[model samples]
Target: MPTPSAPSAPVADGGLFCELYWGTSLAEAWSYGPELGQVHAAPDETAPLPLYGFTLPEEPFLLAERTPRGWRIHVPPSARVEKSLKGDAFHPVGPEELTGAPGRAAVELREGMTLRLVEGELRLLVQPSVVKERAGRFRVRDVAWLITVAILFLSAPVAFLTMGPDPARLAANNARALQVAHDKEEARRKAMGLDQPLKPLTEAERATQKQDGGARVNVPASFGVR
Candidate 1:
């Protein structure tokens, strides 16, 4: 006899980072908006944050995990990281005094990077900007293409639903079904010695049969008319 298979493992409810949030040694905080402590010179226009890849100021660093609300960075406790901070002069002063707050000033990790919290905001300092020249009207063309694709994506299902079966084909199928039913009725009638042609209903017969009034007339009442 063959050996039975083992039962599968139970599925987890949330992502790895989220499931481990409480137990993990690192203190975690969620970002409210799209910005993740981005350092921008332009104070008015808060541009979108930079890419994930960044330069670490020191060996001791935090990791940012993407979450539904926003990005979540995990920072190890001050007590756990105190010894490591001694090696770097640029590290936060008096490491033991450090406390993890949900929303405070952005924490500066290094020369080019900083992490801070303000109310519900979480912004990270990124490297200085690098200007890029536009590739001309090609961008406009790409936008147009994307719009066309989106329209097609939406309209495809509507078109499929709106399309109806051919009227001629439907009529032919109905006729075929009616013929089959008539043949079956004729066979039944022949067995009963009543295989005669079906006469058109007279006005009085139609009225008594309730065919004209949309009410089903009693069979005996219709037969009594003749």
Candidate 2:
């Protein structure tokens, strides 16, 4: 039998930079673990403020372990940092309660990249992807979702006022009501020019709606019936 693999070292132990807030955390606060390259939550090693909620600042730095004691972070001393890293940690190690896994596709996001998380990592193929460009003619899908959600939220009062006596009746009518809402939403989407695929207008479709005659349109009611 293979010499019993020396009990595998814990993924993180005494010291090393570790993210406390995980990804909810901004990229600016990852701190150095005094020893194991884990995040230092202790003051003597981490030194500063915020007894809890402390994390290593995310930036290039030299992380070294202190013997007998725990980890110590060498942060470029600053007034703001002095303010934040100025407290003591109750637990010698950083908070153990947090074993947070990454969100959606746990992929690390470089600054400004709007990442779509896939199976427990940042969706690959776009690692060093470009930051999102500003709004242009078309609203992106996320923007559309936000707009739809707002509309639904504003409509909540209407929903509450219209709820009937029976919960079952409410449930029974919900699908039809939702279907009607869907249809109305579709119509609104079309009016905003969002329902159609985006492409240059076809020459045939752009052909004169007037026969080059007067300001009046030459469109037959039958022409647009479909």
Candidate 3:
């Protein structure tokens, strides 16, 4: 089982780094970003190594650093480097190969190039950073929707101001409504015969009428004789 470690640090401005894949498994890898500074490959007894069962030497076998062009791998004399996967043999390097003095030899790794180290136990791949543009130019269709919404918002007040009737027209409508109500009332009175002129009561009929507005009562002459 191969274990992958989280990025040691946040990706910074340089946006360049080297990815070390454990053996042939592409899924198990570690990213050495520029913010990580320098990375040393050495065995630690206290911490469990997640290098897919491969052990590094007691001394630093390899050192990885970020360079102006790309990532540079420093290889000790004891270690050998397989520069390419396309039939290139593992070659021994010395300090003289890079800086022309006595130190660990350095090799610049470009994008898509794989480097094999520690007798082909570890593999490193160089990957470039990808940036996406967040700000985009507005299209005509995008602006058209905004314009339509603004027009709808502005048209509400204009429609409310223009659609209402003027004061004179409102008064005329009220007068027409009152005339209709009066005409309906007159029609109802005529239907019930209440609209006809009343006939005057004679003197005998007036004598029988009640003074308290109650209905007139009539009594027979022999009602209490028995």
Best by lDDT: 3
Once superposed on the true structure, which residue ranges of model 2 sit more than 4 Å away at CA?
A: 1-61, 64-139, 162-226
Model 1 quality (TM-score): 0.30
Give the Å shift of residue 10 in candidate 2: 21
Worst 10 residues of 2 by lDDT: 77-86
For model 2, how does the per-residue alpha-carbon lDDT over 118-218 read when each residue is reduced to its tens digit?
Answer: 12211111112121222356559878999999999999998887873778887889988999999999999999999988798767767764455566657
RMSD value for candidate 1 = 19.4
The number of the candidate with the highest TM-score is 3
* Candidates sorted on TM-score, descending: 3, 1, 2
Off by over 4 Å in 3: 1-28, 45-62, 85-97, 100-103, 118-226
- Global lDDT scores for all candidate models: 0.39, 0.37, 0.56
Candidate 1 Cα outliers beyond 4 Å, as residue runs: 1-142, 161-163, 196-226
- Across 55-136, the per-residue lDDT of candidate 3 in tens digits comes to 4444444456666555676655444665553345545433344642334467765554456655355554433333212336
Write the residue-wise lDDT of candidate 1 on 1-226 in tens digits: 9999974222111121111122323233222222233212111223222212223333334344334433334442221221113133324335444445632212223222223221112222221112122235658889999999999999998888679577888999999999999999989989998977779999898778875557565566446542
